[model samples]
Target: MDSVQVRPMQEDDLPSAERASAVTFFEAERSTRRVSDPEAEPRSAAASKQWIDRMRFYLSVDPAGCWIAVDEEAGANRAVGFAISQNRGRLWFLATYGVLPSHQGQGIGKRLLDAALAHADGRPGIFSSSVHPGATRRYRMADFSLHPQMRMVGTVDRSTLPVVDGLQEGQADDFAWMDQLDQDLRVAAHGPDHGYMLDILRLVVCRDGARPGYAYLDDRGRASLLAAAHPETAQKLLWEALASSQGPTLVNCITTPNEWAIDVGLAARLDIGQEGYIAVRGMPVPAPYLASGHFL
Candidate 1:
């Protein structure tokens, strides 16, 4: 551990940090699958330009909230762990945190987390976490209330899909209304993150009536982020997302307060499974919201 040091994450560290995260999460998922479905092959995390680009975006927005643990032993400055977070107004959201399996239990993760958390400056915080015991314990010690989260995954039963009304293709003009909805639901607007998401994902917006809502759908037509002023509006947006899917889809980050989402998924005949936890501090789990793993 003496050879390892946690320091602020730099643009140059993005590739190595992303690799560390990929390996860490891959092993974690493999371990979980060994218990839940012994025969299932867990998805592997491969390096991608998109991951580095996303981390670069986070660094551009909140460099102070990102840290990397590097081992300098044997003249190799290898990234063994990393934590990336961002501050959106008064809210701090952790984008990614991970320690390589070879480096686990060496206190590198704790040190990286502490450095990243220091950037929060006592503001409210939130992050979607895996069911790993050590990680959950650390989050609990940080005072975040862990809310069990569920995910719905399966090929949507198109026969059960309903006609969702008022949903239109969103444009840059909808950012103002979408940000307001974000503020109402999560205590702070997503701000610039929306722009990045819009560039890569499809934005479906329903600003037709008093109950406005918006959802960002990935290329596969899966909802990546969603929020609405009312449950009915949320359900409509979610229904549209599911109906638009080209193949198997997933709706994640379903907290207990968002039963409307569960109803929509169940109605679509998607299988429900325990995903992880949405750890939050200084706020309750937002209602009718599906948070982005990298931007919540």
Candidate 2:
């Protein structure tokens, strides 16, 4: 292959770039729901708008990331393939190497990747991303390890929950304790995000009469429960909010590869689909959890 060209994505290129991404992503076999579902990206106006809005987030947030590859022969160097990365001191991959159908397997995909990973400088953090089965083989060919982690969605209606006994949106004064601890925990787990560590404020003192605990929704519509003193408090808080939320209630939770999330889906009677997304962490994976929409 003649030497391929790589460059930074231009300001005007997102439209065509995203359209190409949608075509391939939505066309995938198991990507049926998240990629094609009304609630997923590549579907509806909100999804497209979100993708546009997040370009800046992808650039500033993903360290060691961002590159576009093109087929010089086709004069299609307008990011025929591109990468999205979050660079917060540590590297996290939002998505990398989105190629249009015409460019697949023509070495253009590998060229785009080689350009991106080349920036790793040998000892930098790993090249990370999540892929469904269709993209899995390609990722494997590039030497990225497949993680066992899965993204699961659970559902609950607004009737099965116990009465929300106490979900006071606590005063800032009361939050100092939780706030500091939260920040410390976040930085320890995922490094600094300036004030981002305290960004999610779903914690407030809740009481089922005498029992006091805290639970709050995180930024990504995901929920977090702080076991101030008891484990059940978190569960109760989440269950209460979930059962009371509008209709066809669903909550996305991130717990280590396990069940409360898995079983919740089973119990809520929601279909369990393994999102083609596989998180690629070299050795340590940063916590996108502290900030809910954390992709990279």
Candidate 3:
């Protein structure tokens, strides 16, 4: 055991921080028996690349919001915990936070979080949080309101798939209107984040009549992010997402504000389960919207 110090995360710390995060989350889930295969490695190559890329993007955009805890013993200065956050206009979001199980309960997480919160600068803040008791306690002590989040996962019933219409492939040109929809719902436009998301996810959009909505789906047809002007439009976009899936689908980050998503998932015969929290400060849960865990 050694003294740990919390400091700004450097570009060089990405790999070690990524490992710390992955191991911490895996261990947390394993403790709850939520991990189906305990023998599987926590981070796959593709997932590591995605995480490192995101950390690089955050470091470039808001270096002040990224911090890492390092074991300061001689020859042991490795990252043991980390927190990454980002600010979009008046909104601040916690991108990721984790403390290695080996270093848990030593106040390293709190120190890292305090460092990260400094970047919020009094703006409204939000994050998708795992259902870890210690983490929940910390968020509550920081004055965040935790809204229980639900997730629907399973193979879609193809026979029940409806004829969803009005959705077309989205492009870079659609960013402006999509940003407006973002602002209308969450009080901030996901300006730069939209570009990042567009790089990796397929965007499906609906602009029919007065109902304008957009959803970003992964190759698996899981909705990573979605927002709309009306509940009906939101439901239509969700149904379209499910209908387009090639196999099992996931629709996560569903708060009480977005029951339309639950309806669509249920119609497709997806099973529902409680997962985490949409913790927020100074704002209500966004309705008719499903938030991105990384970008929220």
- Angstrom error at residue 31, model 2: 7.7
Give TM-scores for every candidate, taking all chains together and pairing residue i with residue i.
0.95, 0.63, 0.95
Residue by residue across 129-179, what tens digits does model 3's lDDT show? 988888998999999999999999889999998887788999999999988
The C-alpha lDDT values of all candidates are: 0.88, 0.49, 0.88
**Any residue pairs clashing in model 1, and if so which?**
none
Q: Candidate 2 lDDT, tens digit per residue, 1-296? A: 56456676654667666666666665542344454456443456666665655554455554346666656676665456776554433343344456766666676666666666666544223333345443566677766665544444545643444564556665444554444443332322223332332453444456443444444555443453332333344455555545544444444434343334444445545555543333453543322221233432
Which 10-residue window in model 2 sums to the lowest lDDT? 185-194
| Model 2 bad stretches (over 4 Å) | 1-4, 29-42, 60-64, 72-77, 120-134, 148-155, 163-241, 249-256, 263-271, 284-296
- Candidate 3 residues lying further than 4 Å off, grouped into runs, are 34-41, 74-76
Between the candidate structures 1 and 2, which one is better when assessed by lDDT?
Answer: 1
lDDT of 2 at 125: 36
Q: Write the per-residue lDDT of candidate 1 for residues 112-215, one digit (tens) a residue.
A: 88887889988889999988887998899888899999999889999998987788999999999889888989999999999999999999999966899999
Give me the displacement of residue 288 in model 2, in angstroms: 12
